[model samples]
Target: MENSRRSSLKLFFFVIIFILLAPQALSESDECAAEANNSCNNKARALKLKIIAIVSILMTSMIGVCLPLVTQSVPALSPERSLFVIVKAFASGIILATGFMHVLPDSFDMLSSACLKDNPWHKFPFTGFVAMLSAIVTLAIDSMATSLYAKKQSPGTSGHVVPEGDREMGVEVVSGGENNNFQFHGHHHGSVAVGKDDGSKLLRKRVIAMVLELGIIVHSVVIGLGLGASNNTCTIKGLVAALCFHQMFEGMGLGGCILQAEYKLVKKVVMAFFFSVTTPFGIALGIALSTTYRENSPRALITVGLLNASSAGLLIYMALVDLLAADFMGSKMQGSIKLQIKSLAAVLLGAGGMSLMAKWA
Candidate 1:
């Protein structure tokens, strides 16, 4: 009986030892996890400073972008004013810089980051490929949208009128009236006169403005998210100043486009609001997800990098092909080489200024 009791006591002692040691082991593991979580939380706190900086940047951006749109009420800033053309040229240059220097390079950096795998990302120029495709896609959208709008406006095969000869005479009279209207008021009106020629142009400008805004917003939000999610104080401090200037200049470009669109007051406000809020919203979202969000993580990098690449392509295409090319090649510019040279200088100035900002941003 005593021997049996001793055996039982030994078994109980072993059980007690295991039970105590098990908890201690688990507690140590829990402590390690807690330490890791605390480190993450500290990182998140640092990111909040970036969020604050971005908020300030966005506010200034909003003011800059909305300034031109709201300034239309001033006669000096109206579309017909000569200064308007110069301002537009400058804005276009800024946009050009944004695409080439800011967005495209950032895309290349992200897609080609050393942190990413080598097999596919390093093997291919994904940034350029994506950008090229995006440009092509934007062109398709631009042309198709303009064509669709034209078709809708045109009186089609469902002919309801037989006044063929009078129609030609009426069109001539309307065209003369439109010329007079342009000379006197700097605008064409009357349904027939406005509808035939200026309508399509107006529609095209509106489409361009909206699409450009989309591209800018995508970039702005992505940048804001990066700022808001980053925990690096050194990076954040420089980014704060750089981003402020970045948003201001980019905003001016978008604002110029919006001013040309001639949208209603409500629509103008809405567009300006959208442009202003995108970055702020991104920052807010970043802060909310800071716990789980990793800016350099594989998934986040790929998604944001692709988006930035696409936006850069669209902006570059629009700024070069649509805005700058059209203006430089148009009769207004061709009429005077001096004016063209002046505009070109303005463009270069704007582009140079924006490019300088990229160094810090």
Candidate 2:
């Protein structure tokens, strides 16, 4: 089941990448026509800064992502502890602010740019529309994936072997006959009892981790491209600082999810590598196509704007519904009022930090 989900996710990413790049490919021949005035005084200085940025951002991203993974051995950061919950809450907040404060506004700006024809651009709220549709699509995919996983885990349902949940639940049922059915009756007594099932929760976490990476990478590539194709030294300087912090904070969010997924050592390394390199990869692509890539061109604006809107929707839904809501309403938070307050504060801090960074980025 997990294998199938991963395959589908890969295909989904490929499709999105194609959609984003198709316009760039078509507009290459006419890039000079759509090019905005270059305001930078020193091309050499800008190139130096871009090189510095590439290295700095890459290192920061690696450190941020690997931090959580390496610290998983710490007792305080254990998955069941209160600290983990609080930290995850903060990460969720970062992701939430990323969608609302960063990507969404960028989409609005690009879509509303004066460079594009005023007719359709001003005729309707395409940013909001695309974002809304993306949210709905994310919800549908989330729920369907969960349902499918559960079904696949069922015994004798599809000729696939039953996983741990079914076998454990079955054992309890048969063992009940020998006893006075107390164990079986007690199992379903609480509202959140069923959610404690290890297999189901693990499955959910893995799904969330994979999906969150997809949403994040979409924006990461876009931002990289934006920075890479720009020749303005003044703009690139501020962008370098902003994106470094941006990638670091976003890395923490993704790292938290990856930790919760309980991936194997090899899988963890692979995921971390992917997250760390994506933006740099985008920067590289941007540099290679710098001459032919017009950032303000109509084709570039529309394609990137739509992709941002879609990614914003996906990230917002996943952060709010899957990450925040799920954990807040889970057994752990529900059992403690004080802890919930701390977690909420952590969330605000994370969101506030990201929101501040948005001003420059």
Candidate 3:
């Protein structure tokens, strides 16, 4: 456990050092000179567009994240419903596509940019290497955090977390001691067997959720940096629209994860707020440093590329192993062929929609 903590700390420390190592310069590149001129001519217009992008994207992000959370108030959208299962599967698929179709390719492009060195850069696959290390680090953190949180929980204490939808029914969460069953006591007595996991599974679910948020935050900052640093009004027009949809879809994915994580109101609010503001914060920073920061610069490319690669790995792993497999391989999903079929279709739809968006981005 101590080793795991050290690994997590080291990973973060390394990322900070890597970012600090970036070469800072304000000189514009020759290739970008023409775009820069065009942007200068339409400077006021481009600023207006960027401001619009920030405000609209922020609202869309908030709406997207809050959508699933609001479901806690709707009886029809209860977590136990097949619809919830399908939507979660769809959300997982969206995350999967984000890693595979979006982040991974972007990393490849940036690392392979002509601006980078020919010797070491071309000779090595830094993107894949960094991604692999990041996935391993994420796994370590996930395992360590879950185990620690589970240990901290009092085994003898009984806790009640009444979901909003079940409040009208006076529902109380009942942990099945040393068993895999989760009892929700309402007007009627019944057991919903949560299958093949001890009560610690709930703790694990909560702990693992923060990792998903971490990855999403990293991806958001990268996306925002690109849009913020670019002066090309033509690209910004299309990118702003694409990014709004991007945040909306990704927000749905994160929202679904948060919904299942069983966080308290305060924690949920904090997570959602951080997610809602990350991209905008990144965009603001980019705009402030637009004169000095070049997206295509060797240092900038390396930093963003590595960050994207790491995020891609974390998202891909969580979506596949933690989110999808954990849900699908459970007794309930495996036992129901109809549910499986429905979930697969939902996954396809979500993945296809996100993949299609990649074309414009």
Candidate 4:
């Protein structure tokens, strides 16, 4: 158990060490220091901007995450509507673009940075290697968790009870939604109570939701930390804008997952709070460490690089395999040709928007 916990958590030590050991690497020449001093002429303005950034990002993140949760209060927004599937597809695209356009490229840049040793860094693609390994690791954990959950679930609790209306119609309405399409192989029989086995599917959604949040948290912290530690006000403005949008859309995607997880009220609130505050919290941590945190150091580069790679892999896999593929290839999507076309367009729009934002970041 101890070993397993350590294995699961070993990656976090990279960020911790990056934060703590960064001071020792402050060996930049006088020229570099001189440039930084020249550029940071308006400390007062930068401080105010950073403060605004914190408040702005926090509010936006809260709004984005809570937006989806608020739907539960409204009785009209059923998942059976095409709007729900389209929204989910759009959010999934944003997540996919974040991994491919933002995190993966950042990894490549940091790992292949000019500051690193060319002998190994240039000779091999460590970013790709680490990302691939992380993706495989995530898959292993996903499969293992599913099996374990399946075993522990009692037979009495093996499925959800069909609603009276659904029973009369010989169908389970709740299970037909794109987000709730937990059936395997995209197979569904019309007028059949497929959601009778929703207990196991709910377990799977819970696992995927938690896992998705894990990846998002790691990536958000890294981005926030770098932004907080930056001394350049000119670039900070653009990064802040990009990140605000980034966190908002990512929150929406995560919020959708939380909705599907069907947690208790307290659990739902707790999860939403964490997601809302993660990037801002990372920014605060970075602000506290700014004096000692040298973003360009070799050690910092390697650690952030590997961390980003791992995050990229996890996000990419979850976005594509668990979220996108599960929903797109599900019976819900397959049953509606018009919905599929609309959803594909939504995916492209979301991905395209995120990709455009990457240019600014």
TM-score-based ranking, best first? 2, 3, 4, 1
For model 3 the TM-score comes to: 0.82
What does the lDDT read for residue 299 in candidate 1? 60
What TM-score against the true fold does each predicted structure earn? 0.76, 0.84, 0.82, 0.81
**Residue-wise C-alpha lDDT for candidate 2, range 155-225, written one tens digit per residue:** 43332223332333432322223231212233455322222255567768877887788788788888888
Model 4 steric clash pairs: none
Model 3: CA > 4 A from native: 1-41, 155-198
Model 1, 1-361: lDDT tens digits are: 3322433354345435423432222212112111123333456557667657757976888888987877889999887776777778888998999999989999999899875788799999999999999999999989997776556534542311112122323332223432421111223253333233454566677778777877787787777777666666666677788777777777877888877766655566666777777777667666656555665665666777888899899999999988899778877788888878888988999899889988788
CA lDDT, candidate 2, residue 207: 76
Best first by lDDT, ranked = 2, 3, 4, 1
Highest TM-score scorer? 2
Pick the lDDT winner.
2
Give the Å shift of residue 152 in candidate 4: 2.8
Q: Scored by Cα lDDT, where does model 4 land?
A: 0.75
Winner on lDDT (1 vs 2): 2
- In order, candidate lDDTs are 0.70, 0.78, 0.76, 0.75
Q: How far is candidate 2 from the true structure (C-alpha RMSD, Å)?
A: 5.4
Clashing pairs in 1: none
Q: Which stretches of candidate 4 lie over 4 Å from their true place?
A: 1-41, 155-196
